[model samples]
Target chain A: MSATSPSRSEQVPLAESAPREARESAAPAWRRSPPRWHGVAEALIKTTALVAIVAIVLIFVFIAAETLPLFTSHEVRAEVTPSTMAWKQTWGEAAARWSWQPASEIPKYSIAPLIIGSLKITVVAVLVGAPLGILAAIFTSQVAPRWLREILKPTIELLAGIPSVVIGVFALLVMATWTHRLFGLEHRLNAVVAGCALSLTIIPLVFTLAEDALSSVPKSFADASLALGASKMHTVLHVMVPAALPGIAAGVVLGFGRALGETMIVVMASGNAALVSWSLGVSTRTITATIAQEMAEVVHGSPHYVVLFALGAVLLLFAFATNVLAMRIVESFRRKRGGS
Target chain B: MATIEPSQRSPGGEPRAAVLTAAPSPKLEVRGLDVFYRGEKGGETHALQDVTVDVFPREVLALIGPSGCGKSTFLRVLNRMNDTIPGARVAGKVLLEGEDILAKDYDVVTLRRRVGMVFQRPQPFPKSIFDNVAYGLRAHGLADKREITRRVEQALGRAALWDEVKDRLDAAALGLSGGQAQRLCIARALAVEPEVLLLDEPTSAPDPIATAKLEELIAELKADLTIVIVTHSMQQAARVSQRTAFFYMGRLIEVGATKQMFTRPRETRTEDYITGRFG
Candidate 1:
C-alpha cells in the first residue's frame, strides 16, 4: 500500500516530503532524549574546567595582592589593610622581635637569614642528590639490563608518592635523634637533616626525567660512536649524556623547586629556630617552614597573615624563575637538533 | 654493451696474488668471516656466512649485493662493528697488515683508526665543521690546536671539500647540503688517515651531482689509500672500483676485476643482478 501510494503516478510534494523526513529523524531523537541527564555531563565538564582554571588564577592573584603589603616600596600598607592598623616604624623594630616580625618601615624583612638558610640546605641537597640521581639514571637507562630496569624504575618512582609529612616525621625522630647522638653539642633542627630528607624527595624526579632523557638519545648515535672505536661507556659519556643534557638539567631544576617548596620536611627535620648561620648542627628556618609554622595563628586581616603570604610569594617567584630557565635550556637544545 | 677488461691486472697478477698471501703487507684481509645477529632475545639470524677477500694497497674494491645481503655486515666485520650489537657474533679472522684483528690482544681502536668507515649517511658532530674533522684526531691524541687546524685542512682538501668549507670552518657542518655532508664525513674519517678507507654506500644519500663529486673524491683517495666500497649500482661499482666482490645471502659468490664481473660474471646471480634481474 505504501509503495503504490508514492511510486508510480506522482512524487510527494516538498511540503509533505520535508515533514516526513523531519519526523523520521525526530523518531530516533526521542529515543535518546530520555538520557539527557547523562548528556548534561558535556556542558558540565566544560564549565567545570573553566571554573577550575579561573579559581586557580584567582588564588594566585589573591596570594600576590595579600603579599604586596610586605614590599613597603609597592605600598604604605596592603590595599586591603584594616582601618585601625598603625604604621610600622622601622625595619630594625620589625626584625628585632623574637616572634613573627611585621614588614618594616624601611622593609627590613631580614629574609637574608631565611635566604641563607634556604641556600645552605638547597646546595647541600643538590650536592648529595644530583650526582646520585644522574648516576642511577645512567645505570637504569644505559648499563642495567631490562629485567633490572623494569624492577628498579617503578620502585624508585614509588618513592615520589610517599608523603612529605611522613618523611619529615622519620627525619625528625630517626635522623635528628641519630645526628644528636653521632655529633655532640648540636641542635636537632640542622639543615643537613632536612636537606637529606629533601634529597630523597628530589631523587625520584631527577632519576625519572634524566633516564627518560638519556634513553631518548638515538640508538644510531651510539652505534656510530661505537663503530668509531669508542667504547660503550665513552659513547654514553661523550654522546648520549651531552645530547640529553638539557632534559637532565630540567629534571634537576624541577627537583630543586620541589625541595624548596617542601614544608613539612624542613619544618620538622630542620631546627625551626630562625637563626642565620652556616653551621649544619644549628636550627634554621626555610621560607616554607616559617609560613607553615605561623600560618594558622596569624590574624586573617593582620600584617602577620600578609607576611606569610609574602613568604609564599618568594617561594612562587623562585620556582617560576627556575622553571622558565629550565624551559629555555630545553628550547636551546631543541634548536640544536637541526643537527647536522 | 661493454665487456670485461682488466685495466690494472698484469700478466702474472694471479701468481703474485697467490705468492703474496703470507706476506706481511696486504692492507686488509678477511678469511672465512661470518657475522650473525640474534633476531630475538636468543634467536640467531645469519647476517653473513663464510666470506673471504683481500684488499691490496692503493686499490678500490667494490662490495655489491642486494639489500640485506650482508655487504654492509661484511664492511662492519672489517672493523669489529658487529661486536656492538647485543648477542651479535662474528666468527673468522680479519687481518690488517697481516695482524689478526679478532685476536684478543689486538687493539680494536688502532685497527679502526687504520681502517676508517664512511657510513651511508653523513654524521657530522653537533659542533662546528672544524670540530667534526678534529674529532678523530683529538680522540687519537693529536690535540694541539695548530696541528688540529692543519690536519683538518689537509683532510678536507683530500675530501675535495676544503675550498668550499675553508672560509666557514666555524659554521656548523649540519648546514651542508647532502653531498657536502657526506664529504664532511669522509674528511672526518680521513683525519685519522686510515690505510684502508671503507665507504659503506656513502653516496646513496647524496644527489647525482654530489655522487659525481664523491666518485671523483674516491678516485683521488685511492691514489694513496686503499678503499672498499659497497654499492647497489652496477655502473657505479664498475666506474669507481678496480676489483669487485659479489655477495648473495651472506656469501661471496664471486670476486674479480670489476670489468670482468659485470661483463662475464662467473656466477649467474652476479650476471642476473648486473643485468637488472631479480637480485
Candidate 2:
C-alpha cells in the first residue's frame, strides 16, 4: 500500500504542476484583448465593403429617380400615346411600320423593332456561345493536361480583359468582311456580326463559371465512378455534366444578360437600322444601341429623352431579372444537393 | 522462437479449416511489390516496400497497421486504383490467378471490374438506391432493364439491405443512414459480381453497431468472394480474418494465421506490437 501510495502521490503533483506551469507561462505573454490597430483595420475593411455596396445601391436609386418621370408625367404619356397611335398617319400605310425614327417630321418611336432586334442578337449569341463555352470548360477541367490547361485557360480568360470597344472595332472591320464574304450576305454589318462579336465576350464569362462549377465536384465522386469501371469520357458526360447542370445554366443566364446589356459591340456592328425583321443577315438596333446612339443628341426632358430613359429602365429590369433567375437556379441546385 | 515458414499450398489444397475444405487457390498474389511517389520538390517517398502476400479464395485476409503503413496503397495496387495518382510508380509483380495484372497493356477497366473496392467513407452516388446499385451494370452494359432490376435486387439482398430499403428503392441514396449507406455501397459493388472485394477501413466512419453489422456482412461475403480488408482495429482483424498481415513503416512485418499471430508471434516487433509495447 505504501509503494502504490508513493507512486500515486508523485503522479498527482506532476499532473497538477504541469498545468500550473503552463498557466504561469501563458499568463504574462497573453494580452487581455486584441491590439488597437487590429480593431481599426477590421473596421476599415468593413466600412470599405459597406461603402461599395451603398455606392451601388445609390447609383441604382439615382437611375430609378431619373426614369420615374416617364411614369408620373402626362407629357411623356401624351407624346408616347400619339406617336404609337399615329404610326400609319405619320409614315403612310406602307412605310409607316414599326420603326425607330425619332428625328423625323413626326418622331415615330415604336419599341417593338428594338426589342425584337435585341432578342435576335441575344438568341444568336446564346445559341453559338453557350455550347462553345460549356464544352471549353469541360475540356479544360476534365480533359486537358495540366500544362495545356494552364496555358489555354489563362489565354481564353484574357479575352475577357480586352475592352468591349476593341472587340467592337475588330468585329466591325475584320469579322464583318470575312463573314460577308463567307456567307455572301447583303449587309456586311448586321445582327449576325454583332451577335457573333458579343458571343466572344460571353464565352469567357460562361467558361470561367462553368469551369469553377465542374472542378468543384468532389474528386471522390469521380473515383467512385471510375472504380465502377466507367470510362473517363462516360464519367465526364454523365456524372460531372449532370452534377454541374445548374451552374452551367447560371453561366448561360449571366451570359444572356451580358449580351442583352452590351452597348459598344452592337452600336459599332449592328448597323442601327431599327428594322423589324427576323433575319440574322438584316441590320438591327437593340435597346442598348438605341440609348448609346441617341441619348446624347436628344433634348433633355423631351419625349425621346423619356423614351430612352424608359428603355434604360427596361434594360435595367431585364438585367436584374436575369440575375435573380440565375441565383434562384443555383440556390435550387444547392437545395437539391443538400436534401438528397 | 521457431520461425514459421510461409505456406506453399497448391491451388487444390485447403487454405483455411474454418471455411470449406475444398481445393483452395490464391485468388490474388503480390510479390516483392514497391510503390514510390515522386514529390513536387524532386524527392521520392517510398510508400510501400518489398511487400509480398497472397489472398486465398473465399476467405478474409485483414491488413492491420498504423497510419501511413501502406495498407491502403497495397489494397489499391490489387485493383490498379493507384494508376489514377500522378507520379505514383509501381514495380514488381501483382498476379490475379497466375496472370500478371501489372503487365503493360492490361485492360484496367476489366481488372477493376474483377476486383471492386469499398472506400473508408460511404460514397453513394447522388441517385436512388436502385440506380446506385445498377450503376455498375449500366456502365458495363452488362444487362437489360429486366435483368438489371433483378440483379440490383439480388445484390441488395446479398448486402442484407433489401428489407429495410425495398420499400423505398427509388429514394435518394444520400438520405440513408451512415450504416445503410455503407451497405448500399456494398450492394453497389456486389452488383458487378466481382470475384474479389477490397475494403479499405470500411467501418472507420461507422458507429459501433454499424461496424458490427459490417463485420457480419464480411463474414457472410466470404462465402462468395475473396475479401481483403485493411483495418486499424486489432480486435476486428482477429474477429474477421482467417489470415492477418501486420505492416510497419512501408514494410510487411509479419503474416500468419490470425490466432497464431496474436497469441505467439515469432518476430519481437510483432510481439511487442500485439502486446501494446510499441507500434
Candidate 3:
C-alpha cells in the first residue's frame, strides 16, 4: 500500500494546481485586489475624526487673529490698550477705577466689572445647582428603587434638552415676579434670577455625570460597608460618596465651565446692566452677554470688536482648562486605585 | 504539624460520630431557610432550598461546594446582605442566640453589628488604611477619637496587618497588594467586634502564599469569634475549618467534623463531590 500511494501525493498537487492557475489567471483584476470602498471608507473616517480638532483649531485661530489688532493697531490701541482694559482711569470729573463704558466721548474700557459679574453669577448658579444635582444623584443611585430610577434618570436627563431660551423666558416671565415679591428686590430680573435660571442647565449635566460616577462604584464596596454594620445612610455618605468624589468634582468643574460661557439665559434674564456690585439682587452683565449684545452693533474691526474676541479667547482657554482639570482628576484617581 | 494543632483543638478534633453532637447552645441556628431571587423577566430562581444548620460559638464552620451551589448565598444570609439585592426574598427563622433575626420588626442595624461579613474579593474602601478600619466603629457612633484609633489598631493587629501598615496608615487602602487588601477588609469587619464573622471564599483571589497566610489567620481568629467560611477548595476547608458542610444543588448534603467528613463522607453525593467525581 505504501509503495502504491507514494506517487499518489505527487499527482494531487498537479491536478489541483492546473485548475487553480487557470482560475487565478481567469479571475478579474478587481477580484485580486481589495474592495474599492475600503480605502475610501477608512479615509473618510479618518477625516471625520480630524473634523473636531480642525474646527477647534480654526476657531482658536480666528479668535486670536481678531484679538491681535487690539495689541498691534495704533488706532485700536489708542481707543483701548491692555492697560486701559485692566486698570482704572480717571475720566474728567469722576475718578472711576473699573468702569466698562465703551460709548462715552472718552471711553472707559475697564473689564473688572465684567469679570466680577461673571464670577458672581457663575458662583450663584453652581451653589444652587451642584448640591441639588449631587443630592439627586445620591438618591437615584443609592436610595431609589429600580423602577423609580429607570423613570427618574431619563426625566432628569430630559431637563438638559430644554432650550436655554425657554428657561430664560421662564425666568423673565414667571420667576422674576416671584423673586421680586419674595425678596423685595429693586430689580425683578437680576443676577440671582439669571443664576437660578442657569442652574436648570447645570442640574442635568451634573446629575448625569455624578450619577454615572456614583453608580460605577463597585457593588462590592456597598456590600462591604453594609456588612460592616454601617447604616444605609452611613454606607451611602461615608463609603459610596467618598469613593465617587473625584468624579463628582469633575462633574462640578464641567458644570462650572458650562455656567461660565452660557449667554442666552444670562442675557435675557440678567437685565444687561454693567454695574459691579456685591448684592445678588442687582442687575448684572456677564462677559458672554456683553459679546452677544455688542458684537452686532460695534463697528467691525474696531477696538470694541477686538476686545470681544479677546473675551472669546479667554472663555475658550477657560473651558479647555476645566476639561483638562476634570480629566486629570479622573485619571489620577484611576492611577491611585490601579492596584485593585 | 505545629500550626495544624490549633485547628484540632476545636470540637471537630473529637471522635463524636454523630453529626450534631450535644453541644452548647448554638450561636446562630438557621431553620427552614429558603431564598428566592426574582429575575428581570419575572422568573424566579431558587437559590437556596429548605436548608438548616447551626454555627456553634467560636467554631470555624467551613461551607464547601461547587460553583453556584448556594454556599456564598448562605454566607450572605448570616448578616442579611441579601437585603441589598433588588428582588431578593428570604423565608424562615435565623436565630442569633435565641432571638430571631429574620423577624419583621428586627433591627437590621443591630443584627448586622452582631454579625459582620467579608466578601470573596477584598473590598477595602477607597480611603486611607486607618480610615478603612475606623469606618465601622464610627458608624456605630463611637465619637471619641482615641477609642476609634485604639479599636482600629487592635482590629488590624488581629488581622496580622498592623505592623506592615502602621507607618503609612495614611496610604490609600486600594494601593495595597491583593493579600494585604484582603486582610484590611477583614480588619474592617473585625473593628465592630461582631459575634459572628462570615467569610465568602476569602482566599479564592490570592496566590498560594497569601492563601496560606489567610488560612493561618483564620485558625488564629477562631479562638475569639464564631466564623462561617464558604470555600470551593476541599483542601482549604480541610486545612482551616473545624467542621465542614458540603452543599449540592442548593441543599446541605452533609455537615460533620472536618476530619470525619473528608475521610468518611456518609452520603453518596458528598463522597462524589469530595473525591472529585463530578461537581
Candidate 4:
C-alpha cells in the first residue's frame, strides 16, 4: 500500500504537466466532441416513434369510419332494424334462430352466439392460466434457489416466443384428437380445445409480468417479516403477494385481452360453428374468427361487410377498455403503496 | 425464568478474576464465534474471527467499532440472522438461556421469538399501525382477536407511542413520521415479548431529539429486557450502555465498564480509537 501510493501521487503531476492538445486527443471518445451524426440519429428515432403513434390513430379512425356505415346503411335497416335485430337474435322464431349464416336465402346475423363464444373461451383461458402463472411466479421469486430461479425464469419466457400458428397446429392435430378420445365428445374440434390452447399462449405473458412484480417487492420487507418470526410461506402469502396484487391483476387482464382477440388458435381448434351453447364439448365461433373467416368472401359496401368492420370496432373498444382498467388498478395500487 | 450465572472466565477464554468485582447473570453467551462469507468464485472473506461476548441480563452492552469492523455482524449472530444469507457460514456456539441456538436441529423460529432485532432503517409494513404490531402475534397464532387487540395496545403503550397513535390505530403505518415509524417498529418487536432485544444503530436515521427519546426508551426498557446495541457514536456508547465492547479489524480489543473504557482503556488501540487518533 505504501509503495503504490507514492507512485500514484508521482503520476498525477506528470499527467497534469503534459500538453493540453495531447491530453485532449488522448481522451476517450465520449469525452471528446460528439460526432455530427448523433443529433441526426436522435431526431430519426424520435420521428419514427411519432410516426408509429400516428399510424395507430389513423388505423382506429379508418375502422371507425368503415363501421359507421353499418348503423346507416338502408339495406341493413330494410333487412332488420338494430333493436329488432337484437330482439330476433335473443328471442325469435325457430326457423329465424340464433345463427351466423350470412349468405343464406335470408341472411341471419345474430351476434349473441359470437359474443358468448368469445366470453366462454376467454373465461376458460383466464381461469386456468392465471392461477398457474401466479403460482409459478411465486415459486420462482420466493421459494426457488438462485440457480434454479436463473434456469426457470428464462425457460418460461421462452414459451412466449413460440409462434401462435405452431400452437394452433399442435392443438388442431394432437390435442383435438386426444381430448375427443378422452372425453368421448360429439365434436372433434371444440371450445375446450381452443380455450386450452389459448391458455398456453396466455401463460407466458402472465408469468413474466407477475414474476417482475413479485421480484420488485423490496427485500427489506421480507427481512423484516422473517426477523419477526414469520415463516417463509407466511411472509410470501400475506405480505409479498398482497403488495404485488395490482401487478398480478394487470397481467391477468392483459391475458384476458389477448385471449379475446386471439385468431389463429381459436379459428383452427374451435370448429367454426356459430352456435349459442354453453357445453364445452360443442363447437363455437368467436367474433375475431367470424371476421377472419367471412371478411374475404363478402362484397364491398354490403351489410355483411359493414358488420364485420363493426366487429373489428368492438374488438378495438374491448382491448382499449381492458387496458384502461388495468392501468387504473396499477395506478391505485401505486398510490396506496405510496401511503398518500 | 432463571438467568445463567455469569462465569469468572471472560468470553475470550481468559481469566478476569483480578480486575472484575461482581459478575451478573449472562442472558446470552457467545463463544469463539467465527464468520466467513464464501464467494461463488471459491474465495472466502473472514468477517468475524474469535468474537466472544457475554450479555448480562437487564444491562445495555454497547458495541463500538469503525465501519466494516464486524459490529453489525456480531449483533446479527445473537439472533441467528446470518443464516438467511446464502453463503454465510458461522462456526461457534451461541447459547440463549443455556441452549445452543446454532445447533442444526434447533428451531430458529422459536429462537427468533425469544430474541428480537431492530434494523438500522425503520421498516414498517405497508398496513395499518394496529396490523403492524399485531403481525407477529397473528403469525405465531398465539392469541385470538380480542387478545391481539389487547397486546397491540400494551405494546404501543410500552413503546411510548400510544398517546400519539391511539385514535389512529387504523391509519397506514407508512404515513407515520420517521421517528414514529421507528417507534412503531419497536412496538412491533415488543409485541412478541422477546427476552432479548438486539438494536443495530437504532438512532442512525432519526433526528437528535428522536435519538434522545429512543435513548431514554432504551434506558426504561433495560429494567425488563437485556439489550445488545451496536452503535458508531462514542458518546452514545458512553451514555446508554453499562458496559462497552471495542472491536477493530474483526477482533475484540477491550471489554470493560463504559466509564473505564472511555477514560483509561487498557489497550493502546482502544485508547486511540476512543480518543479519535484514528479509526
Chain B TM-score in each of the candidates:
0.90, 0.91, 0.92, 0.93
Q: Candidate 2's fnat?
A: 0.46
lDDT score for candidate 2 against the true structure: 0.85
Candidate 2, residues B1-279, lDDT tens digits: the string is: 122222344333323333333446578777778999989998999999987777889889999878898999999999888988878999877889988899988988998899999988888877778889999899998668999999999999999999999999987788899999999999999999999999999989739988998999999999989999999888999999998888989998888889988998878887887788875
lDDT of 2 at A9: 68
Instruction: Compute the interface RMSD for each candidate structure.
Output: 2.3, 1.6, 1.8, 1.4
Off by over 4 Å in 4: A1-38, A80-85, A89-96, A338-340, B1-21
Model 4 Cα lDDT, one tens digit per residue, A1-340: 9977876676576569878876665554676577889999999999999999999999999998987766787876665445543544432446556766778877777777888899888888889888989999999999999999999999998988989999999999999999988997879988889998999999999999999999998887887888888888989998899888888999999999999999999999999888889988889899999999898899998888877887788788889998998899888876665563
Writing each residue's lDDT as its tens digit, candidate 2 over A180-276 gives 9999886889989999999999999999989998998888788888887777888788678878878899899999999999899999999889887
Model 4, B1-279: lDDT tens digits are 122233545443334412333465467777778889899898988888886677778889999989999999898888888988889998877888779898999988888889999988888987889999999998898668899999999999999999999998988889899999889989999999999999999999749988998999999999999999999899999999988999898887888779889988889999999999887
Which runs of model 2 end up more than 4 angstroms from their true locations? Answer: A1-29, A81-96, A338-340, B1-22
RMSD of each: 9.2, 5.9, 7.5, 6.1
lDDT tens string, model 3, B19-101? 55566667887777888999999999999887777788989999998899999888888889899887899986677987888
Score every model by TM-score.
0.82, 0.89, 0.90, 0.89
Q: After superposition, how far is residue A47 of candidate 2 from its true place, in Å?
A: 2.5
lDDT of 2 at B85: 86
Among the numbered candidates, top lDDT falls to: 3
Return the TM-score for candidate 4, rounded to 2 decimals.
0.89
